[model samples]
Target chain A: MTAVPNGHDGLITARGLYLSFGAIPALVDVDIDLWPGEVLAVVGESGSGKTTLLNVLSGRVAPDAGAVLYTDPEGEQHDVHTMPAPALRTLHRSDWGFVHQDPKQNLRMNVSAGGNVGERLMARGARHYGTIRAEAIDWLTQVEIDADRVDDLPRTFSGGMLQRLQIARTLVTHPRLVFMDEPTGGLDVSVQARLLDLIRTLVARLGIAAVLVTHDIAVARLLAHRIAVMQRGRVVETGLTDQVLDDPQHAYTQLLVSSVLQV
Target chain B: MIRTEGLAKTFTLHLRGGMQLPVFSGIDLTVHSGECVVLSGPSGAGKSTLMRSLYGNYRAGAGHIWIRHHGGMVDIAASEPRIVLAVRRETLVYVSQFLRVVPRVSTLDIVADEPITRGIAPDEARDMAGSLLLRLNIPRRMHGIPPATFSGGEQQRVNVARGFIAAHPILLLDEPTASLDAENRSVVVGMIQEAKARGTAVVAICHDADVRAAIADRLYPLSPAREAA
Candidate 1:
């Protein structure tokens, strides 16, 4: 596990971010700042532009306005929107990991678990399968997935197991920042609890900053340090998780907090 | 209502030397109307296989499945393939964890296809699809877009909408909320609960404890010993 860097300040800063799907504006003038070694939960109802914001941040979708300024490990700041292709690729390879809501969509269903974890390493030019397999096994163990299943294809894994595999695959490369969209969304309560525990431990041990997009307030309360509440394509509230969740100021936030069914 | 008598499925795996591998055997389960049952187990415990077998996705090697429908109780094992197909098309709905939208199909059309195929009027089917999307909080404009480009969560919602568009009495869901966030999970769960209240016999294979606790009236744990035969 990598140590959280001391005095690691803002790593990513987005100002006046705007995104649209054709003519329908998904996000409008959103601003966010993420520091190293902290978890920031982006919470919102469905169709609230929470995912659009993540897409812009991850470089999968470009913003229509404003700038996404990211600071690399070497302390160089680059405008993410206008960065050169090679530089962007390097940033993606060395600095960022993304976990989508559906593990099957993010994972290569036809390949072995080890192959998925080793893909990032292979992309960065690691050729020896022996070394890659070793690393993959280590990562699988780290994520609490059974190492014996390393040779099994993802199609055979259960939903919770698949999510864990996806996490191991993304984090094996040791990226500085990770973005997870609904990491524990559909998991059984036991599985959700286990996955959340694993994520909390891994993030703390590695000191990797993360942006987690979730609709579950409990998840945000458990894993996030700071929470940003979004609604109708805008940030309605932003504060510490406990404060935002327990004492939400906006009507939407209040409704979300109140709507949570205690099980 | 549905009942299984020592229901068993075993796949004969032909290895390089033609050796066979037994997948599962001698499984018994039942699902009653107005009830939601969750089947959970470790990965590769044959949860999906069992769910698929209920809808006849996999032909059982042995045992019998008796489905009690409005028409009558029919032995699924002894029924003709065409009869099973007709029953599945009209009365049973299966939602796989991964969205399986056909290429070039619009979201609206995907949801409306099953009902239309089953002879529901096109306009009524479209209305049903639209209402389902609205209930699930999917934006109205997205109805016309092809599901191919939608995000993972969005596509899953479309898939769920399509699966239940006809309000089939028997619904099988394999991790229906696997791609949903917390809010959407609740919405989908509520929808499922509504279906159960409407007397739909639902068997959901899930790994989420929260979902199971929220919706399942009964639970079954698939054992590895049972899966390995």
Candidate 2:
């Protein structure tokens, strides 16, 4: 467990979180704090409970123990664990944006790229077509995808481009906190570099806090301000990206850093 | 090796005034075995159209495509529709970027269908599918779950697993890794490397330089004028 840092407003807090499926524990005794305008990378190997922690924070999976505390833009702290379904849905729609490991799951694959972005605005009741399209195009441009592909189905775009479109769709809603799970996992190495660069730029420009869950240390190093290393549902280490990566105190952190082939 | 000579595809789009638009015309290219070739271009550059022609998804308006398989050289352009279908089903596999998971199908069944459809025993197909799922890191519990219920990355992995099950020698991927996180991307790249190592001739359509740089051994840029050539 890592203590919450001071001064910055805490946007999301998880204390003593525990989750299990059947006889297997996915996460246990996990505590994390996300501050405004900070990008926190959650790193772990496969089945290391990184995705479970993300699901708990985003209200997709209920924790068997403890609480997920989230502060809305209005400065009200709500226990995500206990929120009513409808209230949680509302909070998800208005305040939180989630990007899945696969862009297609987050995006409506049948619709055009613009429609995917516009769907978010429409969900919040922006019905005027032209206004929605304009806003969608603006977001697409921001994400570095061509605005011309707005009418093309996501099926037509390349893998890296589709990821950019997904980013555009999520950010179009202007959510305060974005949760990205392995945002660049399946791209080619060069595309991965470019997409990571785009995410770094957009997170800073939008001033949106993000919790990035990934298994790649290099990805965390590129995009995250703070890094939390997890193993078997426990937060093994958490600190500034440089401190944790360069001078890892925990043995697990040291092992993780050591595994990377330093160029 | 696969070679296209003056292959062309065109579609007439009916506008409000009933005018026509030509989508693509006169494309020529060649792909050799033991090589990974990437087709790159902006939107509407006919990259997908050209790739589709190789598999006979669309009839070529002119010229021909010759594919040298183990048995003999076949004119893909002039092959019978049924023959083309059989060829695509048995020898060529295409993994589109946007996953097309059939409705009401379990993940295991979806993957196993590749082998079963091609005449493998159901039991053997199931065993093979299980092995692939394991290699792809999809949990055993998820094997029986409907693909619709799985997350995006999970579905994509299932899709890849299915595509590779047949051990098709020529695999066509249309932006397979788009929108995936770094871990998933690495997994997909690794899968491609494995496929290549298995002697699959991979033709991938991608715009992301990183993706091409990661997997492509050769690159072909598709421009309107170059497509005419």
Candidate 3:
């Protein structure tokens, strides 16, 4: 909020956002700027409006007030809420990825893993099934899933493998910006560690910008370049991940960080 | 190569209802190239905090940290996170009291990662990393394992190896030899001397008096801020 980081506009910027679910405020005066290839984590306790903020930023949920501006590759900025539905859908299909906390929400369990991955490329206008299949296999490998498992149905995969398949399906499109809502959540600790490592490597290797929402401070510390601490639908503090985590400046941030003690 | 003016850090513990803990303030410090300045102070005198501030891990509440980065002076306090990270990668390097291990990253790759990111070839970087680890007495078998499984002394040695391998222009070491045996401590002392011989600006906080005596060109004593404030 204080420094604009040399004034190069972010790939996505949401300013002064306010949203309400009838009587309850879900988001209140939240502002965020995510630069290209930078991972920004939104961290707070449950009911901190983190998921609501992500939905609004990704154009899934419309905010009652404020603007979400997205700069396309051509340097043209699109007002996300004002954009036509079809155009925003195209953006979601091409330049943006949304990885849900539950892989089941993102993946079609009936589709084979390979079919799931290739479908995105097909949606992007790839007509040749062979090429799409090759790229799908390649992505499965990238996400550390075996290529031989390509034809297996999602129902056959373990929870961690399903998440990995979902990640492969999302990343097969090479979306420049990813919206990850607890990509490592809901798994055992060991599985979570592996998935986190995979996400870190993939995000770094591709230089994919991400806006990750997690209640886990350790996840933020592991994956984020910047951290925005939220409480009661408001950003209490925002800064470099190491700075905020190690030397928290806000009361809510301090509490959020101090809650996770070193084992 | 490193200069600070009125450098101060105060923590306002928000959970404690905004209780301000002044670590230090009103300080001026400087270290020229090829010099090793040891921060001599008792515990709780903000020695490690100063090291973290220099590395841009903590946002200083007041003052300027003018660092010679990429042949230009940049004040890290005023700079944004992007600029601060750039300064850290290209110019500044730090070895803290503990190794913050990334899960499953091999110890060799951990040390080699610094040079590899800074444009060295991976093969050459790993070779250099291997040699440094060997010199620091890390066994050959330990290189393939992550530092998470390493003992305190072993991990500290890996940290020492990593800090020296890149040969960055500015080095900040916080208790670099804290948990090591006398032999490894002396080995680290020798490495610090070698780093300084190459015109690197080193600022360290070493409580070991013998190690301090061997490497310190000047002792910059930090008085308790509680006394000064």
lDDT of 1 by residue, B40-135 (tens): 778887788788778776666688888875568877766644356557767788898766533455788778877776768889999999999888
Docking class of 2: incorrect
Task: Give every collision pair in model 3.
Answer: none
**Candidate 2 C-alpha lDDT tens digits along B77-138:** 77643355457666788786555543445788879876775778889999999988887789
Better of 1 and 3 by TM-score: 3
Task: Estimate, for each residue in A36-134, the C-alpha lDDT of model 3 and write its tens digit.
Answer: 989999999999999999999999999999988999888889899999999999999999999999999989999999999999899999999899999
Best by DockQ: 3
Lowest lDDT sum, 10 consecutive residues, model 3 chain B, at B220-229
C-alpha lDDT (0 to 100) for residue B190 of candidate 2: 86
- Name the weakest run of 10 consecutive residues (lDDT summed) in model 1 chain A: A1-10
Q: Tell the DockQ for candidate 2.
A: 0.01
Comparing 1 and 3 on DockQ, the stronger one: 3
TM-score for chain B in model 1 = 0.93
List the candidate 2 regions with Cα displacement exceeding 4 Å.
A4-8, B1-229
List of chain B TM-scores, one per candidate: 0.93, 0.88, 0.97
- True lDDT of residue A37, candidate 2: 79
Rank ordering of all candidates by TM-score, starting from the highest: 3, 2, 1
The most accurate candidate by lDDT is 3
